[model samples]
Target: MSNSGTPPRRLSTGGQPPIKFLLHYVVEQVPSRNGRTPCFTAWLREELASGQITTWNDEPIRVEDTRPEFAIQVYDTTTPPSQDSGGDVDQRLQALAKALHAETRGEREGPPGRDRDRIDVWGLPLSADLSDEERIATCKAHLLAEIAARDGGETEFPIERIGNSFTFGRALYIIDRPPSRWDEGEGGILELLWDVNPGYRAMMVHEFGEKYETYEYEPIVTRVTRAELGNQWLMMRHGASR
Candidate 1:
């Protein structure tokens, strides 16, 4: 729960390019009668099969906070992907980041007074350590795990890579077709963009529509940490079936 007036800070992408992958996650506060106990925490406990996590961003992941009822932090990998691999590193990272963003926070539009789920997305620099092949493989592995979790062990709808674009060696674009249940259309598309120079920039665009209806697009901005990112990936990997 970020303050309405103060926007959460975006991660700085300038100095010390990412050498490791980190995932940051945030969940809206779940209400309870007795008191507020973050449901996200309970969900994480079930997925990890252990309630104990020692650190996040070099500090404890669990800390007291008045705002943002639920949060998670984790890392995808401490070492970079192998280099001998031939693949688009930026595209793969962008796809994972966009997918994570969509999973945690999707588009929502409804009348007033209606309760809805909210989540945020944070973009960090792609780790320079992993090789192109490694990055692509890592992204595919994570996506497969997520698809399995979402499809209840039935992966009828496989993750699809639409395409990607690179701009003047500074900007990167990635598109993905993820699983969906809309009877009117095939599935949803996630688009991600990243720029390195003149300060790092990241953006996400989600598009979906019914068969006869015009497509709907939503843009998002918010960031999470490595640990939180990891938590989301794990939840998608382990919690969806439960």
Candidate 2:
């Protein structure tokens, strides 16, 4: 431990930057409280098509017309343990979460009452666990469901897992690839990247430089009900107990 004169070895060559991204959505309209907002699932599809971002996993993302507005903030850099120890991994995970949270909305720049309500009232909670291949299958299922729902019936979207958390928004999906593992400093692994309805797309662009060279999409505006949002929240809090 006394050999302090030597510099530490580098983990990645490009001097990877920390996760940078943001999340935004339309909270309320001028005159309409009868659930005139859009669905989150629909926005997912729009994001993939837009090509402003990229995914670590090439999974299918479908947008349902019935889902609410929700978005995610993705980052491009993958930070690693400075010392390659267990604790380092934890730190990396925490960093990712902090980035994600910052992208979503931090203490100062966060959305106000109406905007926050949109995420809380319109969005649906998407939670799942699986491997890379399994995750792909899950995404396909979600895409199909979203498409079906858009035509008429209800549908669901897929869950995407990167380094630490899963993602579920148009702009957010592309910002950063999901982490394969976790950092020790964060104190917890990002088991999931949960997305609710009434997605977040604008915020990600504002925070993370738009990966327009990769993908971009617009927010999908559809009708989302409070009951549906409640169900989504329940699913998020209890992990599909609803």
Q: How would you encode candidate 1's per-residue C-alpha lDDT over 80-119 as one tens digit per residue? A: 3464132343344334433444444322211231112222
Off by over 4 Å in 1: 6-128, 152-242
Report the lDDT of model 2 for residue 153.
37
Candidate 2, after superposition: displacement of residue 77 in Å? 25
lDDT of each: 0.28, 0.28
TM-score of each: 0.21, 0.21
State the lDDT of candidate 2 residue by residue for 1-242, as single tens digits: 01111112112214543222222222221111233222221110012223333422364322222323332322222232243565554344344433333233333122231122112111112233334334333433443444344454332322222111212322122111234323223312222232322223333445575753234442222222322323333233222311
